[model samples]
Target: MPRYLSILTFAAALFCGACQNSHSDSKNQSSPEAGVKPAFVAQRGTPVLDGSGSDDLWEASDWLPINQIWAGTLPKPDDFSGRYKLAWDENNLYILAETTDDVLLDVHPQALEHFWDDDCLVVFLDEDASGGTHEFSYNAFAYHIALDGSVADVAPDSSFRYFNDHCLTRRIARDNVNTWEIAVRIFDGKQYKDEGDNVPMLLKKGKKMGFALAYCDNDHSAERESLVGNVPLPNTQNKQQWLNADVFGTLELR
Candidate 1:
Protein backbone atom coordinates (compact mmCIF):
# COMPACT_ATOMS: atom_id res chain seq x y z
CA MET A 1 0.00 0.00 0.00
CA PRO A 2 1.07 3.59 -0.58
CA ARG A 3 1.96 5.82 2.34
CA TYR A 4 -0.32 8.48 3.82
CA LEU A 5 2.15 11.19 2.84
CA SER A 6 1.30 10.72 -0.83
CA ILE A 7 -2.42 10.34 -0.20
CA LEU A 8 -2.59 13.59 1.78
CA THR A 9 -0.67 15.42 -0.91
CA PHE A 10 -3.06 14.19 -3.58
CA ALA A 11 -6.12 15.04 -1.49
CA ALA A 12 -4.80 18.53 -0.83
CA ALA A 13 -4.26 19.13 -4.50
CA LEU A 14 -7.66 17.78 -5.49
CA PHE A 15 -9.63 19.71 -2.85
CA CYS A 16 -7.77 23.01 -2.89
CA GLY A 17 -10.65 24.76 -4.65
CA ALA A 18 -13.07 23.82 -1.88
CA CYS A 19 -11.01 25.70 0.69
CA GLN A 20 -11.93 29.04 -0.88
CA ASN A 21 -15.65 28.58 -0.35
CA SER A 22 -17.01 29.46 3.09
CA HIS A 23 -19.18 26.55 4.19
CA SER A 24 -20.56 28.48 7.16
CA ASP A 25 -23.21 29.95 4.88
CA SER A 26 -25.69 27.11 4.68
CA LYS A 27 -27.96 28.63 2.08
CA ASN A 28 -27.26 25.93 -0.49
CA GLN A 29 -25.28 23.41 1.52
CA SER A 30 -26.64 19.86 1.59
CA SER A 31 -26.38 17.19 4.20
CA PRO A 32 -26.53 13.40 4.07
CA GLU A 33 -29.48 11.60 5.58
CA ALA A 34 -30.12 8.05 6.71
CA GLY A 35 -29.40 5.54 3.97
CA VAL A 36 -31.61 2.71 2.78
CA LYS A 37 -30.81 -0.98 2.92
CA PRO A 38 -30.80 -2.59 -0.50
CA ALA A 39 -29.82 -6.21 -0.73
CA PHE A 40 -27.20 -7.00 -3.35
CA VAL A 41 -28.45 -9.94 -5.29
CA ALA A 42 -25.97 -12.37 -6.74
CA GLN A 43 -25.70 -12.27 -10.49
CA ARG A 44 -27.40 -15.14 -12.27
CA GLY A 45 -25.31 -14.64 -15.38
CA THR A 46 -22.79 -12.18 -16.77
CA PRO A 47 -24.60 -9.03 -17.80
CA VAL A 48 -23.32 -7.00 -20.74
CA LEU A 49 -21.49 -3.85 -19.75
CA ASP A 50 -23.28 -1.67 -22.26
CA GLY A 51 -25.20 1.35 -21.04
CA SER A 52 -28.51 -0.32 -21.78
CA GLY A 53 -29.99 -2.04 -18.74
CA SER A 54 -31.64 -4.88 -20.67
CA ASP A 55 -30.12 -7.86 -18.93
CA ASP A 56 -32.05 -10.39 -16.87
CA LEU A 57 -29.92 -9.62 -13.80
CA TRP A 58 -31.01 -5.99 -13.78
CA GLU A 59 -34.64 -6.97 -14.15
CA ALA A 60 -34.40 -8.99 -10.96
CA SER A 61 -32.30 -6.44 -9.02
CA ASP A 62 -33.84 -3.78 -6.84
CA TRP A 63 -33.68 -0.19 -8.02
CA LEU A 64 -32.97 1.95 -4.98
CA PRO A 65 -33.72 5.64 -5.49
CA ILE A 66 -31.06 8.18 -4.64
CA ASN A 67 -32.89 11.10 -3.05
CA GLN A 68 -30.59 12.31 -0.30
CA ILE A 69 -28.83 15.65 -0.75
CA TRP A 70 -25.36 15.72 0.72
CA ALA A 71 -24.33 19.22 -0.26
CA GLY A 72 -27.28 21.22 -1.55
CA THR A 73 -30.99 21.82 -1.12
CA LEU A 74 -33.51 19.12 -1.98
CA PRO A 75 -33.94 19.00 -5.71
CA LYS A 76 -37.32 19.29 -7.37
CA PRO A 77 -38.85 16.27 -9.07
CA ASP A 78 -38.36 17.81 -12.49
CA ASP A 79 -34.73 18.57 -11.80
CA PHE A 80 -33.40 15.05 -11.31
CA SER A 81 -34.18 11.54 -10.15
CA GLY A 82 -31.74 8.60 -9.97
CA ARG A 83 -31.84 4.93 -9.04
CA TYR A 84 -29.23 2.17 -9.09
CA LYS A 85 -29.19 -1.63 -9.07
CA LEU A 86 -26.48 -3.85 -7.68
CA ALA A 87 -25.36 -7.41 -8.40
CA TRP A 88 -22.16 -9.29 -7.73
CA ASP A 89 -20.51 -12.39 -9.06
CA GLU A 90 -17.50 -14.20 -7.74
CA ASN A 91 -14.96 -11.93 -9.41
CA ASN A 92 -16.67 -8.60 -10.05
CA LEU A 93 -19.32 -6.19 -8.89
CA TYR A 94 -21.91 -4.79 -11.28
CA ILE A 95 -23.81 -1.51 -11.09
CA LEU A 96 -26.54 -0.17 -13.31
CA ALA A 97 -27.60 3.39 -12.56
CA GLU A 98 -30.41 5.05 -14.43
CA THR A 99 -30.84 8.77 -14.03
CA THR A 100 -33.43 11.22 -15.30
CA ASP A 101 -32.16 14.70 -15.91
CA ASP A 102 -33.35 17.59 -18.02
CA VAL A 103 -29.87 18.32 -19.27
CA LEU A 104 -26.77 16.22 -19.74
CA LEU A 105 -23.45 17.98 -19.26
CA ASP A 106 -19.77 16.97 -19.33
CA VAL A 107 -17.55 20.02 -19.32
CA HIS A 108 -14.55 18.38 -17.75
CA PRO A 109 -12.93 16.04 -20.27
CA GLN A 110 -9.73 15.32 -18.49
CA ALA A 111 -9.60 12.04 -16.61
CA LEU A 112 -8.35 13.17 -13.21
CA GLU A 113 -9.23 16.85 -13.02
CA HIS A 114 -12.50 18.56 -12.09
CA PHE A 115 -14.73 15.52 -12.60
CA TRP A 116 -17.19 16.66 -9.92
CA ASP A 117 -17.77 19.87 -11.89
CA ASP A 118 -19.58 17.78 -14.43
CA ASP A 119 -22.35 15.28 -13.87
CA CYS A 120 -20.81 12.21 -12.27
CA LEU A 121 -21.47 9.17 -10.10
CA VAL A 122 -19.11 8.20 -7.32
CA VAL A 123 -18.83 4.88 -5.46
CA PHE A 124 -16.88 4.48 -2.26
CA LEU A 125 -15.97 1.04 -1.01
CA ASP A 126 -14.03 -0.44 1.84
CA GLU A 127 -13.44 -4.04 0.85
CA ASP A 128 -12.17 -5.15 4.23
CA ALA A 129 -14.81 -3.26 6.27
CA SER A 130 -12.07 -1.74 8.44
CA GLY A 131 -13.21 1.79 9.23
CA GLY A 132 -10.70 3.35 11.58
CA THR A 133 -8.56 5.13 9.01
CA HIS A 134 -9.22 8.78 8.21
CA GLU A 135 -6.97 8.49 5.17
CA PHE A 136 -7.32 6.14 2.24
CA SER A 137 -6.34 2.62 3.14
CA TYR A 138 -5.50 -0.36 0.94
CA ASN A 139 -8.99 -1.67 1.56
CA ALA A 140 -10.84 1.57 0.69
CA PHE A 141 -11.49 2.60 -2.90
CA ALA A 142 -13.25 5.66 -4.31
CA TYR A 143 -14.28 5.64 -7.95
CA HIS A 144 -15.41 8.79 -9.76
CA ILE A 145 -17.44 7.89 -12.84
CA ALA A 146 -17.83 10.91 -15.07
CA LEU A 147 -20.60 11.51 -17.54
CA ASP A 148 -18.14 10.86 -20.36
CA GLY A 149 -17.49 7.32 -19.06
CA SER A 150 -14.18 8.13 -17.51
CA VAL A 151 -13.23 6.46 -14.23
CA ALA A 152 -10.79 8.07 -11.85
CA ASP A 153 -9.54 7.20 -8.40
CA VAL A 154 -8.26 9.50 -5.65
CA ALA A 155 -6.45 7.13 -3.38
CA PRO A 156 -3.18 5.14 -3.65
CA ASP A 157 -1.80 7.91 -5.90
CA SER A 158 -4.86 10.02 -7.01
CA SER A 159 -4.40 10.57 -10.74
CA PHE A 160 -6.39 8.06 -12.78
CA ARG A 161 -5.53 4.90 -10.94
CA TYR A 162 -6.72 1.85 -12.83
CA PHE A 163 -8.58 -1.08 -11.30
CA ASN A 164 -8.50 -4.60 -12.77
CA ASP A 165 -5.90 -3.47 -15.30
CA HIS A 166 -8.51 -1.17 -16.79
CA CYS A 167 -10.76 -4.14 -17.54
CA LEU A 168 -13.68 -2.13 -16.16
CA THR A 169 -16.37 -1.33 -18.71
CA ARG A 170 -18.68 1.70 -18.60
CA ARG A 171 -21.14 3.22 -21.02
CA ILE A 172 -23.19 6.42 -20.95
CA ALA A 173 -26.25 7.48 -22.90
CA ARG A 174 -27.71 10.93 -23.42
CA ASP A 175 -31.09 11.50 -24.92
CA ASN A 176 -34.05 13.03 -23.14
CA VAL A 177 -32.55 11.20 -20.13
CA ASN A 178 -29.11 9.97 -19.09
CA THR A 179 -28.08 6.55 -17.83
CA TRP A 180 -24.92 4.49 -17.20
CA GLU A 181 -23.74 0.95 -16.47
CA ILE A 182 -20.52 -0.17 -14.85
CA ALA A 183 -18.70 -3.40 -13.98
CA VAL A 184 -15.36 -3.62 -12.21
CA ARG A 185 -13.40 -6.24 -10.37
CA ILE A 186 -13.76 -6.44 -6.64
CA PHE A 187 -10.47 -5.54 -5.04
CA ASP A 188 -8.97 -7.44 -2.16
CA GLY A 189 -7.42 -5.57 0.76
CA LYS A 190 -4.19 -5.56 -1.22
CA GLN A 191 -2.54 -3.29 -3.71
CA TYR A 192 -1.57 -4.20 -7.26
CA LYS A 193 2.21 -4.11 -7.25
CA ASP A 194 2.59 -3.86 -11.00
CA GLU A 195 0.93 -4.43 -14.36
CA GLY A 196 1.61 -8.14 -14.15
CA ASP A 197 -0.56 -8.76 -11.11
CA ASN A 198 -4.26 -9.57 -11.41
CA VAL A 199 -5.26 -10.36 -7.85
CA PRO A 200 -8.93 -10.06 -6.87
CA MET A 201 -11.06 -11.18 -3.97
CA LEU A 202 -14.41 -12.88 -4.31
CA LEU A 203 -17.36 -11.33 -2.45
CA LYS A 204 -19.31 -14.06 -0.69
CA LYS A 205 -22.74 -14.18 0.87
CA GLY A 206 -23.17 -12.61 4.33
CA LYS A 207 -19.85 -10.80 4.01
CA LYS A 208 -20.12 -7.11 4.90
CA MET A 209 -18.28 -4.26 3.24
CA GLY A 210 -18.31 -0.53 3.69
CA PHE A 211 -20.10 1.15 0.82
CA ALA A 212 -21.64 4.48 -0.26
CA LEU A 213 -22.96 6.06 -3.45
CA ALA A 214 -23.02 9.69 -4.56
CA TYR A 215 -23.80 11.81 -7.57
CA CYS A 216 -22.73 15.28 -8.64
CA ASP A 217 -25.04 17.57 -10.58
CA ASN A 218 -23.78 20.48 -12.63
CA ASP A 219 -26.33 22.22 -14.81
CA HIS A 220 -24.07 24.05 -17.26
CA SER A 221 -22.82 26.24 -14.43
CA ALA A 222 -19.41 27.25 -13.23
CA GLU A 223 -19.85 25.04 -10.16
CA ARG A 224 -21.84 21.98 -9.26
CA GLU A 225 -25.35 22.51 -7.88
CA SER A 226 -25.41 19.50 -5.62
CA LEU A 227 -23.37 16.64 -4.14
CA VAL A 228 -25.93 14.02 -3.31
CA GLY A 229 -24.80 10.96 -1.36
CA ASN A 230 -26.45 7.86 0.04
CA VAL A 231 -24.85 8.18 3.49
CA PRO A 232 -24.21 11.07 5.84
CA LEU A 233 -21.04 13.02 5.22
CA PRO A 234 -20.73 15.24 8.25
CA ASN A 235 -18.14 17.99 8.82
CA THR A 236 -17.83 18.43 5.08
CA GLN A 237 -17.99 22.19 5.49
CA ASN A 238 -14.34 22.23 6.42
CA LYS A 239 -12.96 19.09 4.83
CA GLN A 240 -13.85 16.44 2.31
CA GLN A 241 -15.34 13.85 4.60
CA TRP A 242 -16.28 11.62 1.70
CA LEU A 243 -12.69 10.57 1.31
CA ASN A 244 -12.74 8.96 4.72
CA ALA A 245 -13.91 5.34 4.84
CA ASP A 246 -15.46 5.86 8.27
CA VAL A 247 -18.28 7.91 6.73
CA PHE A 248 -19.52 5.11 4.51
CA GLY A 249 -22.34 2.69 5.30
CA THR A 250 -22.25 -1.09 5.41
CA LEU A 251 -23.11 -3.32 2.45
CA GLU A 252 -23.77 -7.02 2.96
CA LEU A 253 -23.35 -9.47 0.11
CA ARG A 254 -26.53 -11.50 -0.08
Candidate 2:
Protein backbone atom coordinates (compact mmCIF):
# COMPACT_ATOMS: atom_id res chain seq x y z
CA MET A 1 0.00 0.00 0.00
CA PRO A 2 1.14 3.54 -0.77
CA ARG A 3 1.83 5.93 2.08
CA TYR A 4 -0.42 8.95 1.73
CA LEU A 5 0.31 10.81 4.96
CA SER A 6 2.08 8.39 7.29
CA ILE A 7 -1.32 8.23 9.03
CA LEU A 8 -0.41 5.52 11.53
CA THR A 9 2.02 8.03 13.07
CA PHE A 10 -0.48 10.84 12.82
CA ALA A 11 -0.08 13.28 15.66
CA ALA A 12 -1.57 16.76 15.53
CA ALA A 13 1.04 19.35 16.26
CA LEU A 14 0.67 22.28 18.67
CA PHE A 15 0.16 24.71 15.77
CA CYS A 16 -1.92 23.05 13.05
CA GLY A 17 -4.03 26.00 12.10
CA ALA A 18 -3.72 28.02 8.88
CA CYS A 19 -4.31 31.76 8.68
CA GLN A 20 -5.21 31.39 12.34
CA ASN A 21 -8.07 29.00 11.51
CA SER A 22 -8.22 25.59 13.16
CA HIS A 23 -8.86 22.29 11.39
CA SER A 24 -12.23 20.58 11.36
CA ASP A 25 -12.49 16.79 11.77
CA SER A 26 -15.45 16.25 9.40
CA LYS A 27 -14.12 18.47 6.60
CA ASN A 28 -10.64 16.99 6.75
CA GLN A 29 -12.06 13.55 5.87
CA SER A 30 -14.32 14.76 3.09
CA SER A 31 -13.23 13.87 -0.43
CA PRO A 32 -14.57 15.02 -3.74
CA GLU A 33 -18.23 14.02 -4.02
CA ALA A 34 -18.71 10.49 -5.45
CA GLY A 35 -15.10 10.63 -6.67
CA VAL A 36 -16.06 13.37 -9.05
CA LYS A 37 -13.27 15.88 -8.54
CA PRO A 38 -13.34 19.42 -9.85
CA ALA A 39 -10.75 19.43 -12.61
CA PHE A 40 -9.10 22.62 -13.82
CA VAL A 41 -6.99 22.03 -16.89
CA ALA A 42 -3.56 23.65 -17.07
CA GLN A 43 -2.84 24.83 -20.56
CA ARG A 44 0.51 23.85 -22.05
CA GLY A 45 2.41 27.11 -22.29
CA THR A 46 5.78 28.44 -21.22
CA PRO A 47 5.00 32.02 -20.43
CA VAL A 48 7.49 34.60 -19.17
CA LEU A 49 6.97 35.12 -15.45
CA ASP A 50 8.07 38.72 -15.12
CA GLY A 51 5.36 40.14 -12.89
CA SER A 52 3.47 40.88 -16.07
CA GLY A 53 1.40 38.47 -18.12
CA SER A 54 2.60 39.90 -21.42
CA ASP A 55 3.12 36.56 -23.13
CA ASP A 56 0.63 35.39 -25.69
CA LEU A 57 0.28 32.02 -23.96
CA TRP A 58 -1.33 33.73 -20.98
CA GLU A 59 -4.62 33.90 -22.86
CA ALA A 60 -4.79 30.14 -23.11
CA SER A 61 -6.85 29.65 -19.98
CA ASP A 62 -9.74 31.65 -18.60
CA TRP A 63 -9.40 33.49 -15.29
CA LEU A 64 -10.47 31.34 -12.34
CA PRO A 65 -12.35 33.07 -9.53
CA ILE A 66 -10.69 33.40 -6.12
CA ASN A 67 -13.96 34.12 -4.33
CA GLN A 68 -14.37 31.20 -1.93
CA ILE A 69 -14.25 32.42 1.66
CA TRP A 70 -12.44 29.66 3.52
CA ALA A 71 -12.06 31.69 6.74
CA GLY A 72 -12.96 34.97 8.47
CA THR A 73 -15.52 37.51 7.28
CA LEU A 74 -16.02 38.17 3.59
CA PRO A 75 -14.52 41.48 2.52
CA LYS A 76 -16.33 44.26 0.71
CA PRO A 77 -16.13 44.33 -3.09
CA ASP A 78 -13.72 47.25 -3.11
CA ASP A 79 -11.79 45.87 -0.17
CA PHE A 80 -10.60 42.80 -2.10
CA SER A 81 -11.19 41.17 -5.47
CA GLY A 82 -8.99 38.62 -7.21
CA ARG A 83 -8.73 36.22 -10.16
CA TYR A 84 -5.99 33.94 -11.41
CA LYS A 85 -4.94 31.84 -14.41
CA LEU A 86 -2.77 28.75 -14.69
CA ALA A 87 -0.35 27.56 -17.38
CA TRP A 88 2.34 24.95 -17.45
CA ASP A 89 5.11 23.58 -19.56
CA GLU A 90 7.88 21.03 -19.25
CA ASN A 91 9.84 23.22 -16.85
CA ASN A 92 7.42 24.95 -14.46
CA LEU A 93 3.84 25.70 -13.47
CA TYR A 94 2.98 29.33 -14.16
CA ILE A 95 0.45 31.39 -12.23
CA LEU A 96 -0.83 34.88 -12.96
CA ALA A 97 -2.86 36.43 -10.17
CA GLU A 98 -4.53 39.84 -10.22
CA THR A 99 -5.73 41.20 -6.91
CA THR A 100 -7.17 44.61 -6.10
CA ASP A 101 -6.90 45.43 -2.44
CA ASP A 102 -7.49 48.59 -0.51
CA VAL A 103 -4.24 47.99 1.35
CA LEU A 104 -1.37 45.52 1.21
CA LEU A 105 0.27 44.46 4.46
CA ASP A 106 3.36 42.41 5.33
CA VAL A 107 3.45 42.77 9.11
CA HIS A 108 5.37 39.64 9.94
CA PRO A 109 8.88 40.11 8.58
CA GLN A 110 10.01 36.82 10.04
CA ALA A 111 9.15 34.11 7.54
CA LEU A 112 8.62 31.37 10.13
CA GLU A 113 6.39 33.08 12.70
CA HIS A 114 2.86 34.18 11.94
CA PHE A 115 3.69 34.70 8.26
CA TRP A 116 0.13 33.85 7.27
CA ASP A 117 -1.05 37.20 8.64
CA ASP A 118 1.09 39.12 6.17
CA ASP A 119 -1.40 39.23 3.34
CA CYS A 120 0.23 36.50 1.29
CA LEU A 121 -0.72 33.78 -1.14
CA VAL A 122 -1.18 30.22 0.08
CA VAL A 123 -0.67 27.37 -2.34
CA PHE A 124 -1.90 23.91 -1.39
CA LEU A 125 -0.47 21.04 -3.42
CA ASP A 126 -0.47 17.25 -3.26
CA GLU A 127 1.85 15.69 -5.82
CA ASP A 128 -0.32 12.60 -6.39
CA ALA A 129 -3.64 13.98 -5.21
CA SER A 130 -4.05 11.07 -2.77
CA GLY A 131 -6.17 12.87 -0.17
CA GLY A 132 -5.22 12.53 3.49
CA THR A 133 -3.96 14.44 6.54
CA HIS A 134 -0.63 16.17 5.85
CA GLU A 135 -0.47 18.40 8.91
CA PHE A 136 3.06 17.34 9.79
CA SER A 137 4.70 15.72 6.77
CA TYR A 138 5.75 16.28 3.21
CA ASN A 139 2.87 14.17 1.79
CA ALA A 140 1.47 17.55 0.82
CA PHE A 141 2.52 21.19 1.20
CA ALA A 142 0.79 24.40 2.21
CA TYR A 143 3.18 27.08 0.97
CA HIS A 144 2.74 30.58 2.39
CA ILE A 145 4.13 33.03 -0.16
CA ALA A 146 4.81 36.42 1.40
CA LEU A 147 4.79 39.78 -0.33
CA ASP A 148 8.58 40.06 -0.10
CA GLY A 149 8.94 36.93 -2.25
CA SER A 150 9.55 34.76 0.78
CA VAL A 151 8.15 31.20 0.73
CA ALA A 152 7.74 29.02 3.79
CA ASP A 153 6.25 25.57 4.48
CA VAL A 154 6.13 22.97 7.22
CA ALA A 155 8.95 20.45 6.97
CA PRO A 156 9.00 16.80 7.99
CA ASP A 157 10.41 17.90 11.33
CA SER A 158 7.09 19.64 12.01
CA SER A 159 8.83 23.04 11.97
CA PHE A 160 8.29 25.90 9.60
CA ARG A 161 11.07 26.27 7.02
CA TYR A 162 11.75 28.38 3.99
CA PHE A 163 11.33 26.65 0.63
CA ASN A 164 11.98 29.75 -1.41
CA ASP A 165 13.54 27.98 -4.37
CA HIS A 166 10.41 25.88 -4.82
CA CYS A 167 8.40 28.86 -5.98
CA LEU A 168 9.88 31.92 -7.73
CA THR A 169 7.60 34.93 -7.38
CA ARG A 170 7.48 38.46 -8.79
CA ARG A 171 4.88 41.13 -8.29
CA ILE A 172 4.14 44.61 -9.57
CA ALA A 173 1.89 46.64 -7.32
CA ARG A 174 0.42 49.84 -8.68
CA ASP A 175 -2.12 52.07 -7.01
CA ASN A 176 -4.02 49.40 -5.06
CA VAL A 177 -3.93 46.64 -7.70
CA ASN A 178 -1.29 43.94 -7.62
CA THR A 179 -0.19 41.65 -10.43
CA TRP A 180 1.65 38.62 -9.11
CA GLU A 181 3.34 36.16 -11.43
CA ILE A 182 4.78 33.01 -9.96
CA ALA A 183 6.58 30.01 -11.42
CA VAL A 184 6.10 26.86 -9.36
CA ARG A 185 8.25 23.77 -9.52
CA ILE A 186 6.62 20.56 -8.35
CA PHE A 187 8.40 18.02 -6.18
CA ASP A 188 7.41 14.57 -5.04
CA GLY A 189 6.36 14.96 -1.42
CA LYS A 190 7.35 11.42 -0.55
CA GLN A 191 10.92 12.10 -1.73
CA TYR A 192 11.33 15.76 -0.81
CA LYS A 193 14.34 16.46 1.38
CA ASP A 194 15.13 19.49 3.49
CA GLU A 195 18.93 19.47 3.14
CA GLY A 196 19.36 17.27 0.09
CA ASP A 197 19.19 18.20 -3.55
CA ASN A 198 15.73 17.64 -5.09
CA VAL A 199 14.80 18.01 -8.73
CA PRO A 200 11.38 19.32 -9.74
CA MET A 201 9.25 17.08 -11.94
CA LEU A 202 8.80 17.94 -15.58
CA LEU A 203 5.13 18.62 -16.27
CA LYS A 204 3.35 16.63 -18.99
CA LYS A 205 -0.06 16.14 -20.49
CA GLY A 206 -2.62 14.00 -18.64
CA LYS A 207 -0.86 14.48 -15.32
CA LYS A 208 -3.11 15.07 -12.33
CA MET A 209 -2.49 16.64 -8.90
CA GLY A 210 -4.32 18.08 -5.94
CA PHE A 211 -4.11 21.87 -5.95
CA ALA A 212 -5.72 25.00 -4.49
CA LEU A 213 -4.95 28.74 -4.27
CA ALA A 214 -5.79 31.10 -1.44
CA TYR A 215 -5.05 34.59 -0.18
CA CYS A 216 -4.73 36.04 3.32
CA ASP A 217 -5.89 39.61 3.86
CA ASN A 218 -4.78 41.77 6.78
CA ASP A 219 -5.12 45.45 7.42
CA HIS A 220 -2.55 46.12 10.15
CA SER A 221 -4.27 43.74 12.59
CA ALA A 222 -2.65 40.97 14.59
CA GLU A 223 -4.65 38.37 12.60
CA ARG A 224 -5.82 38.22 9.04
CA GLU A 225 -9.23 39.59 8.23
CA SER A 226 -10.23 37.23 5.43
CA LEU A 227 -9.06 34.09 3.69
CA VAL A 228 -10.12 33.66 0.07
CA GLY A 229 -9.66 30.34 -1.61
CA ASN A 230 -10.18 29.00 -5.12
CA VAL A 231 -12.22 25.90 -4.31
CA PRO A 232 -15.62 25.93 -2.65
CA LEU A 233 -15.23 23.88 0.51
CA PRO A 234 -18.19 22.25 2.32
CA ASN A 235 -17.60 23.78 5.74
CA THR A 236 -17.89 27.52 5.41
CA GLN A 237 -17.22 27.92 9.11
CA ASN A 238 -13.81 26.28 9.59
CA LYS A 239 -10.68 26.15 7.47
CA GLN A 240 -10.26 22.41 6.96
CA GLN A 241 -7.59 23.22 4.41
CA TRP A 242 -5.54 24.26 7.39
CA LEU A 243 -3.72 20.96 6.98
CA ASN A 244 -5.80 18.60 4.83
CA ALA A 245 -5.18 17.84 1.16
CA ASP A 246 -8.71 16.47 0.72
CA VAL A 247 -10.13 20.00 0.80
CA PHE A 248 -8.23 21.11 -2.29
CA GLY A 249 -9.40 21.14 -5.89
CA THR A 250 -8.00 18.97 -8.70
CA LEU A 251 -5.76 20.03 -11.57
CA GLU A 252 -4.87 18.19 -14.76
CA LEU A 253 -2.20 19.10 -17.27
CA ARG A 254 -3.30 19.48 -20.85
Find the candidate with the highest TM-score and give its number.
2
lDDT of 2 by residue, 3-121 (tens): 64555334344234431342342243212332355567789988777898777888656787787678888888678888888888888888899888898998778648888888999
CA-lDDT, candidates in order: 0.66, 0.80
Please give the lDDT score at residue 66 for candidate 1.
Answer: 67
Candidate 1 is scored at a TM of: 0.73
- Estimate, for each residue in 19-103, the C-alpha lDDT of model 1 and write its tens digit: 4443333223232232333223344346888777888878887676666667765667657777787777776677788777667
lDDT of 1: 0.66
**What's the CA RMSD for each of the models?**
12.6, 11.3
TM-score of 2: 0.84
